[model samples]
Target: MRRSPWATLTVLALAQFIVVLDVTIVNVALPRIQTDLDFTADGLQWVISAYTLVFGGFLLLGGRAADLLGSRRVFLTGLALFGVTLLVAGLAGTPGALIAARAVQGLGGALMSPAALSILTVTFAHGRQRNIAMGVWGGLAGLGGTLGVVAGGLLVDSLSWRWVFFVNVPVVVALIAATPLIIRAVARRSGHGFDLLGSVLSTAGLLALVYGVVRAEPVGWGSAEVVGCLAAGVVLLAAFVAVEARSAAPLVPLRLFRSRALSSSSGALALNGASFLAMFFLTAIYLQQVRGASALRTGMEILPMGAAAILVAVVTPPLVHRFGTRTVQLCGAALSALSLLLLAGTGADSGYASHLLPGLILFGAGVIAVGVPAQIAAVVDVEHHEAGAASGVVTAFYQVGGALGLALATTLSVSRSHAALADGMAQQQALVEGFHRGLLVAAAFAVVNVVVTLASPRIAPSAEQIAEAAATA
Candidate 1:
């Protein structure tokens, strides 16, 4: 019997949701994890960073593997590994063990994410079907962050922090059992080799760069250790680019940047991601630190944003159809900038109902407006065979932007607080000063996104045109 395409898409979407949720789930659980594992103040970031580094580093390689090996095979293998990793992470006795397990989970996610996306690209015949499918995919991806916070709060409050990891096991098991019946098998392509050197250089360079940025607050930018890591990271990335230019089977095809829409959309996405991640991290902290809210209250307070985002995501396709992708994206960027500006006014005395909710709604709407169009534009011209790789590249940069954004916000916040402390300001005043500085930085990043979005190509292909191109490819 033939498998149902809808079933395949459903399973794939669920898998993707799980992977993305894991990326943010640990945020709410950080305090709990710290208390249980005896983690130092600096070590708290590692819980999130460990997963991000491995996931971002191997994503290109994972996409290539899905193409060469076989999507179904890789998908199943990744699911199994992911389940095991989650189990190990949940059962971990020490911080080191948990971090290692998180890294392993990231490896599995890198493999699974591209494979799931590749399956969707092939299974869903392009046109309105593909557009709707992509919209659902994008929506689920957006919802992952919100659900992570809510779910993490419930689990952490009701059960143990380990339940956060354990919850993934049943989901993985169900997916593995049903996958064969839902997803069709694609024939494996031949004549491709792994770009091992390129992978190594890219991964190591990114890890080093992130480390340097994260440590800058404590060690100071002038420290030899920080300088050495940053310098080495740059040299390694340069080498990676050189290798890609010369290699027969490059992990990242430099030619992808030739398309103006693709290039501009990618740049805009990086900036957008930086702002979105910064907002999430900062808001989570603000609710806890300033308002003295519990995890549940913080998660609930942010529910308005998620609700607004869902409404926008639902309306976005028709808006794009009417106004064209470029116009919608430009509008989205402008609105996001305005949202950030509004958020910058938030202070200790501000109420969520009066001050924060409006900003949250605007932020949600703006992000959906920009996010959908930018995502669509990024993959507009790619061949079907390269769709997975294209998606991988976009996701990688998004994660990179997220990690760097958090580090950047942290740095600004710390610097402002430090200066205020040196000036003999009250602790509360210093913290508020830091938060304000971070908000301004985030707003600046969003404004940069506006410029990048404007540079995107004005031409918007119809659903029919997109389907025709995919069919021929």
Candidate 2:
């Protein structure tokens, strides 16, 4: 008896949901974790940054592993690692221990995310079903991020902060049990040896680059540590590309980017991620600092945005099918820009119902609209053999983009606030002005994505591409 495809999708989606949820869920619990574990104010940030850095760093390697070692093998291995790390993190008595666990969890996430996506790409035919699946996948990705705030607040308020980590344990256990029943195992690919040099270069380069970027705002970007890391990362990545071009069994085949759809999708996803995360970051500040909302209240306020995203996610696939991918994506980009513009227009006296709610709703709708189509486009042209690598590439772009965007927003917002204060402006007025500037920066990112989307070749599948996609399924 064969398992239903939807069942397989459910298992995969749940794995992805937890992976993404973990990224943000720990945020609300950070203060509690710090209090309990005696973390230094500086050390406390590692709780979030450790996971992000490792997850982004190893994604490429994880994806390629799925291709060579078999998705089922990698997926299960990642799930087990993730589950054990959750336990360790929850029980950790010191900051170092918790940070270490979080770092390892990031590695597990790196493995699980790409493997699950690779499976999805091959599981469904590239048509309406695939589009719908991508929408659900994209929606859940956004939803997980949003819900993390709410769930963390509720859990930390009612129970202990450890519950944030503990809550996912049962879900992971269930997924591990269901995975073998639903997803059939495949033999590992033969004749293709791992590209150890490329993997080392790519991983080191990404880790350094992400570390530098994340540290830039806290420690000046021009500081020796950040500069050295950025320089080293760029040099190492360049070497990695050179090595990949010549390697017979390259970790990431250089040829994958030749497809207009794949390349454009990668760029578009980066900008989309930049705008989305920047918007979230700036809005959180606006609510908490400007409006004097509590952490729990802030999460509750953002609920409408999540609701809007869910609605748009359901409708976006059909919109893509009807209006075509480019048109739909352009529309999404437009909505994102409009949302940012609305946010930029907000002032200290603006009311949530009148000023914030509408912008948040549009943002929720806009991001999903752009993301689902862009995600679908990313893999539509790739061969099944390289699907994992392709998935890894696009996902990596989104993560890195978010990190870069948030860093930029923080730096600019702070700089602007300081400048205003130096000019004798009131602190509240200075902060609001700084936030407005940050919102515009996010809007600029959205506008850039619109141009990139418009310039790319349309993603309508050719008959040959459609046939290839069908064969993959």
Candidate 3:
């Protein structure tokens, strides 16, 4: 049976929503989870970090699996794993068990996210339809993080924090049931063998990299464990690259990076993710700790950010049609940096309506503008067969960048706060100063992206180029 492209998108979007939602849903519930699970202060961070580490680590494998095994098969398999793990996490009685469940849940997300994206890339032809589809995907991705906060607060306030994990179970079940009916499966491509060595090297390398970066926040960056993990990650990833350069069947095709559009988009997306996620972390802390707002109220306050992102997602494609993608990306990056600069101006007594709303709204709009184009550019010119690999590269960049950003921001924030306390500043004032420093780091990332965007080729591939590339493939 033929399925409407819209129906296919709906199913994919819902699956992705839960995947992205899990990234930040636990933020507001962290304290509750710690209390209930008796998590040590240092151990509590893993509930969030475990998911991030595994999710970022396994994305490349998942994307390649979709290419070799079939996107629909990988998507469904991931969905099932994700659903089961969410159930286990919700019911977990011990801290270790919950963290274990979260780690497996990250694995499921790693598989589902890129597979769904590959499906979308192939389903819609390039041009207006593809832009609109990616716009929706980009918007949903941004909205998921924002909604996670809102949903987390509501669930934790009215129910237990366990509901944060449980809430997605029903959605997962629905997506599993609905997917096959709407989207037909493609047969796996022949003539391509799985690259086992590349898979192991890339996955282990990414896992080590993420683990080191996330761990650096709690442990000093100078610690032996951090230094060892970072060194191992770099060496392993370098080896993975060398292996791919020689392999007949590479896990990630080196040729893909030759496309200036895809390469630039990957880099820009990393900086974009870094800025956006770090900003969220900084603002969330500012709301709860500085203003002393309830979780529910903080979520409500952040609602406008999502609204602005949706608005930009809807409007950006047309702007790209007229102004060109590079223009819009530059403007978006500028706005994002400006938003963070504005946010950095917030004092200990700053009011939400007067001080914070402008930046929040601009951030929402800015991130979507940059993200929608980056998302489109990453897969738009790639051959259909390599769409999964292209998707994985960009998605991996964003996830890894987000993890790095959060870690850096947390370390900077804590260090600044402690320094201020040493100088005998009031606790509230010192905390706000630390948040300011973190916001500046986020703003710096966006500013750096501006330079990155300026240095890259044009955002959209020309029609002639796309055709020639397609013919070449």
lDDT of 1: 0.79
How many clashing residue pairs appear in each of the predictions shown?
0, 0, 0
Runs of candidate 1 with Cα error greater than 4 angstroms are 38-43, 93-95, 126-139, 181-184, 381-388, 422-424, 465-473
Tell me the lDDT of model 2 at 383.
Answer: 76
For model 1, name the residue pairs that clash: none
- Across 392-457, the per-residue lDDT of candidate 2 in tens digits comes to 677777766765666566567767787898999999899898899888999999999999999876
Report every candidate's CA lDDT: 0.79, 0.79, 0.80
lDDT of 2 at 247: 94
lDDT of 2 at 422: 90
RMSD of each: 2.9, 4.0, 3.8
TM-score of 1: 0.91
Q: Who is ahead in TM-score, 2 or 3?
A: 3
Instruction: Tell me which of candidates 1 and 3 scores higher on lDDT.
Output: 3
Show where candidate 2 strays beyond 4 Å: 1-10, 27-49, 91-100, 117-146, 177-184, 214-221, 382-388, 418-434, 461-473
**How does each model score on TM-score?**
0.91, 0.83, 0.86
